[model samples]
Target: MPIDALVYLSMTVFSLPIAGIRMFKISSLSLSIGMSAIAAAALTACGGSDDGAASTREVALEFVAVAGHTPVQCGTLVSGLGTGSAPAQVKDLRFYISNVALLQANGTETPLTLSANDNWNLTAGANQITLIDLENATGACSNGTPATNAVIRGTVPAGNYVGIKLTMGVPFALNHTLYSDVTTAKPPLDIGAMAWSWQSGRKFTKIELTDPEGATGSWTAKTFAVHLGSTGCVGNPATGETVQCKAPNRMEARLTSFNPDQQKIALDVQALVAGNDVTKNLGGAAGCMSGGTDPECAGVFRAMAIDWKADGTGTGLPIAAGASQTIFRPIAR
Candidate 1:
């Protein structure tokens, strides 16, 4: 019952004469106590909160793939992509992200509590990950799946968020696992193309582009691939042991002024390959594979603002400290 109705009923019952109370075989004090108990129970059942606390609000941070100012699609040609201004078709564009946070004006960061789902988002212990799939299984992106996810959905404490921060990789605890193990691997983690079995971890970023002419010069097979993952990994997950990596090539990006409501983060293919000729591969894998000594990785790492060393133990400088990642930037929606 409503509190007002309960109050009125209690007053009416309390005003009853001693004869009415005697008929009920209860004293006036006892009847008053019973009414008070009922009122307390009603209040408890109504979900009333007297304390003032900020409620959480749902946020869907948007993202997009672009080549310079033009939007990127599987079959469509992205012009002005590399140092050679190469026009190529996107073969694959997928990446994993974690540790999403919204920044406050006072420089405080509030973690985005991801909404757990079977497909895109998963939270295991202290790790929260979301896969951002920008390519559909069309044209050159046939290796990818038909489904695509371009937004990171989560909840954050209600406040005026001024910026956004995220890490472009899966967490260590969840990264090193068997991709073929169906019971253990989940949606985003179950993808075979993103798995690196030799390293016992995932390719944090799998970005590939192909020349339309099918040319095979320094760029053999007419494809330039940039696969980012932990390199120089030690230990074996197959033996049920923890894995350690010398260079966890996870890229971190932070936008000091981002409005999630009105802007979307854009990953520019042009910016990623601007420092190198995509048509040429000097050494190592066909393209950059997070190898510290790979000539192709220098340009990619420089674009990502990650310090690179030839010895494979290049986790030295902190790029995120200066917030200098050039591949991802906020654009008006």
Candidate 2:
């Protein structure tokens, strides 16, 4: 029974001796025994007894952005990045994470039940996504909003979790929604800067940096943007057709040594662009946009451990087993 109902019952039983002692003529010893039995039953039903069911506890997975050893912030210059060791100003930094799970010593995976708030975190059926926005609107992050979120809050079964696994992209079902209609759309998905109309999906990652030198080349663009999203998408939901993409471009990270209480996930910008020259864009857009023919995506994909063919027909695919991602790593808090 509910706690309120139990309390009412207990009150009525206790008042019987004073108000209905003559009417019922019940013995004190019998009434005492009945009350004890009722209390025992309620305790068992409420699991106050020794039960083997595991309890769950709230957990917060923190994330941060860095360039080598320097912390990344909007308008702040992070040097020693890219192949040329070029210094660039932070512009934008945001990404989505989903399908979080905690790993046990024996490789058992337990899904982390997300705390949905209709804002940064949302859970629809089997899909749970959280937006990690590290950039505030201040400084060079003028295109972003003032609000920022970097922690993915959820609940996990109470146990010793030694590892963590998560996907760095929004699920396809929630990705193709009408993001432009912010009046009805939910937050995180409603962000205009993360939406891509061309692919009819949201940008999984928006990491942009401004090249200070603006080196002269075929592409003299000052901003080196890395927008990762699904490519070669066929069909449109707006037209009442099912949407699908050839390349999902979702990156999964599995850290076998992560401890949520003592460590944080660090997105190293220097490692992300270490193989490419930040001063210039070799071909296809200002920077890699998850294009098949883009030369700049090779380094980014390699760092993420995603496969990409150089023949211009490359579909962004997850690398083979045993390979690991370099962009996201576990660092001491």
Candidate with the greatest TM-score versus the true structure: 1
lDDT, candidate 2, 1-333, per-residue tens: 644445445544333345545534445456667766786687666545344444676889999999877889887778998888877877889999988999999988899998865679888778888999999987778888788999998998677789988888888888887787664346778878888764468999999988654344232568888888988888877777888887888888888899988999999999999888877879898878988878999898888887777775665677752157788888999
How high is each candidate's TM-score? 0.82, 0.81
Query: Which residue pairs in candidate 1 have backbone atoms (N, alpha carbon, C) closer than 3 angstroms, thus clashing?
Result: none
Write down the lDDT of every candidate, Cα atoms only: 0.81, 0.81
- Name the weakest run of 10 consecutive residues (lDDT summed) in model 2: 211-220
Regions of model 1 farther than 4 Å from truth = 1-54, 215-221, 311-313, 316-318
Give the poorly placed runs of model 2, Cα more than 4 Å off.
1-54, 182-185, 213-219
lDDT of 1 at 31: 62
